[model samples]
Target: MTTIPEIARAAGVSTATVDRVLNRRTPVRESTSRRVLDAAFSLGYVTSSDVERLSESEPLTLAFLLPRGTNPYLALVNHRAHAFVERNRRDARVKSYFIDGFDPDELARSIRHFARRADGVIFMAIDHPKVRAATDEIVASGKQAITFISDISTSRRHAYVGIDNFAAGRTAALILGRFNGGREGRVALIAASRIYRAHMEREVGFLGLVEERFPGLSVSATREGHDDRDENYQHTRRLLDKHPDIIGLYNVGGSSDGIGRALRESGRAQDITFVGHGLTRDTRAMLADGTMDAVITQDPDALFEAAVLAATKGTPPVVTAELYLSENMPPE
Candidate 1:
């Protein structure tokens, strides 16, 4: 007999999507819906017959703690999650919460608050031990905790939903190398911080690929951007002065919006091939203007869905590694 798992595999979707499709609970694309129905027919799978018979189920209250700020990306996450919850409320009764920024104390307080009422909590990965302890407390109190954007303590969260930092890094190196066609020159890297696991992992992957796959390129120096554009710009400016031969650049974190400005002012923009992570509005515009060559992005909807699913459904989502180019994505 074909299970929901089988249907999901056949349909190239998550198991939750399978459940939604079968129950007539959520809208699936026509072509995909047809494929799923056909697969079910072939395998003798009946939609929702068994789900309807399940004895006990609880409507989940899922809370989302995200970076509190005016950033469009973060705002989009909140909007998408709220929309999902609203759409699924009749059946699942899902609820979510948002926290501004990376304040550990505020996050801990929010976790404790949601733990009182929620079945699950989804938090942006803040690597502080206190934050991990708070999540551990939530899990111990019988509520699931899921990590989003970055991975935190494994023992605290139910699952992690984000890109493979190592793979993202390797992608940066690959793009830069191919963009340069493996010509010999120093490459500069700017990142949010060496302590951030996401940025560190990317650097590790990029360095490994550069050493093994593109031996012609040498990583000259790395600067910690601290997620601040001004600092990133200053650091990049210093690096440019110190390493005049730098022909390639990769930013794993804050894109040093100022770095681009400085490079343009110095008339070195055309001399360097730059690749960065994230598809912020500014970065998108930069790509359009030829200031950036490529961007590594984690799907916003996918990331939010993964966080929600991990909390409500206890499922770990598969993170997709995507490289966006100007030609592929016009300025938005």
Candidate 2:
């Protein structure tokens, strides 16, 4: 971490002066404060408060491009991000737009639109040539572009503010494999879509770990639901019908409610081990009712905060995944 003394030294100012600027305990000249802020920002140590004091003119305009959906987790992210902006009205001007996550042409166009309107752009990216080209073009135009939730490959996005999906996949596998009592037959994997880099990575990690550690558990079927409840329900029912050997089910994306309903109606909810991502109300209820065995999740508020930091300060915080079970579910 960059310390105050380091920022003060880089700015050729006293530590007391830096403190005064950061805390607003006393008035410091705008030029001196800008110098300190520049030093702190260069060192990847600028905080929201530091950016708060960096400018007295127009605030920095940032845009968040999210997916339009009823997925509770994404909705929570959108809510928290807007709430963050409301709280930091003096430091940032945040505009959030919901776009289709699977439409590359629309996503790419939205990126360019935000690039023209905002100082920074943060979005859930679909990994496609069109999106990658747009990312490059936006960055070349001298604006910050950060990828949220899902990222694009070969893009110029400054930072990604989400947990490691591959590791989350491996964690899901590890939990499900152990929960099967060493008598695994097959595992089914479901994702939102493989077009998002995060889903693809998670699928790879889950399959790799299941094969590496649990030899008996073969991944027999993979399906895409696009995080839609009805689609996930239909897919899950079909999977259960076709794959009687499935001893474990791993949801690499959202819409766990549909999966739960399918398993419960199939009268085999307790026979198979189920693991999924996110800690939304649906998952929480499923976990309590024994439909879900475990939830591998990251905090939504923490993720939004990291996204803001990455967008404004160029320093993204690491958001670690948390495991939730019925017995150890967090207090709301």
Candidate 3:
């Protein structure tokens, strides 16, 4: 097998430089690092066991800052992270913290607290200046900062590991429109908040598609659910009362349970074509009962693995959005 010394010689760098680039213990010039990696790959110098041994010597400590809520998707993400750490025990350790609310100052403090402790940090970011500044500072301090599920565009996050949310929105719109089948009534949009970039982007895509393709279907003004079941229930109830001809509903964020409850209470469960995000237990039941028409989802397991890989390997995995329906729901 080829060796690091041979790769260093071929790349015209010293063995120490090659080691530093491979281990990522210290910063190296981007050009030099690329050259060394290219040489190593060309010579097939590093084996999987060699990489595993290196990881065992310097195990990664990754901290995940997730939202504190009953949102099934976030719970799934937390579960997947722990599972990954257990499966790769020698390579990494994951510690997850749940931020209680949408206070950017509190979130910033949490980020700073983990800055010096973990090798990398991942979070579902709110698109606020304070949070963005904190993320950029973490990246500048030589720790990887990754955004998962949602992104803060202004920050210097190493990478984002989730589906293309705008595309997911467009896909949802396509499904909703088809399911409604030439209906000429209002479609309501519900979201967690405009502060979440992912939800905002999804809302934009959904609105654009509706305006372009479903002109006959008017859209109600967006209502913020804050991913709260009660809040979403109120929003749905209000929309139903105001728009008696509502034909479709698209929930761009969480709280499918509240939406389903409102629909059932109003005796509109079968009348409205509902499309929501996340394939949680609530959504699965709703799908089976004909309350939710389809669910737009991304694999939480894939997201956790991508975040880990990005933190340790400097390459992020791409996860695509999945469409789940009653017939195709994956078994728990």
Candidate 4:
């Protein structure tokens, strides 16, 4: 299938301009819009107005909610989802949001707010009771609520479309524990937020394995970065200052650039074994420069495919965590 980037190339326009024309979110100059439409039609990415317009009984709307940030992983998935909907415009209206997933009340309100327009919701959830109640209500209202990445297991979401986070965590622990070469020292955990079920599970898995297998490694600290680069930098700097002898560092969530920076700035990048999640461009750089030792990540394309499959009630694509090291890094 032709992609938005391809359409942009054919039209001699930027992808953002292609998005403006396709999604109709902003006004485009008549000439530019015409060029984009012509390119799209030629590339089979567009339909005629009659075909594009929804019928009177049109009620198929899918909502995908994600945490608001420039987190490399989330940004990549968001772009993929938008392009998917753009390519499949005949199916249903797609409404996606970058929300404060950590804010339980706000997230719950957003879920309820979609009742008027959305037939389904796919979101990364905060494992909170309010969010669970909201999911149940959405499911009860005859709409689907699917969890992805972070899950609310107790919630009435229709399905979860992601990897086994606990296993992913264990994998990280295994890598860190083994890679340390029998040197026992304090390990620190840096997370986006424990409110996120994925981060909590990963932390638990890491801690559990460290306790069970690496009895000599003690968990020195677990700091919440809130997935903010600056916040992670600050927290990591403080953690390093407090525990100068720290040996292993595990990042269970995003904003790893900050953690990497902190370690390097503290002159501890090579001294500490750092493992993180999400194999984005940034992480690839870290691994190449020997800043990060290993990364535990799932396929991003599979993630987008699985969410859409869950929305359509199809067999969701299988997602599994893969480890990445400098030697095996994919070509940029």
Note the Cα lDDT for every prediction shown.
0.74, 0.86, 0.87, 0.83
Best by TM-score: 3
Q: Write the per-residue lDDT of candidate 1 for residues 1-332, one digit (tens) a residue.
A: 56888888877778886776566664455566666666666677854554343212445667667664334455666776777767754334445565644566887788878878777777766677777888889889888788777777555678988888889999999999999986898999987666456778889999999998888888976787666667777888888888888899898875446667767777788779989877778778778888889988877767776776676556867989778888998344
Q: Which 10-residue window in model 1 sums to the lowest lDDT?
A: 49-58
- What TM-score would each prediction reach against the true structure? 0.73, 0.83, 0.84, 0.80
Off by over 4 Å in 4: 1-60, 87-92
Prediction 3 TM-score vs. true: 0.84
lDDT of 3 by residue, 222-255 (tens): 9998888899999999999989999999999997
**Model 1 segments more than 4 A misplaced:** 1-59, 68-72, 87-110, 330-332
Q: How accurate is candidate 1 locally (lDDT)?
A: 0.74
lDDT of model 1 at residue 281?
Answer: 80
Model 3, runs deviating above 4 Å: 1-55
User: Pairs clashing in candidate 4?
Assistant: none
| Model 2 / residue 272 / CA error / Å | 1.4
lDDT string, candidate 4, 87-184, tens digits: 75454566778888679999999888875567788888888899999999988988878888988867778888888888888888999999998897
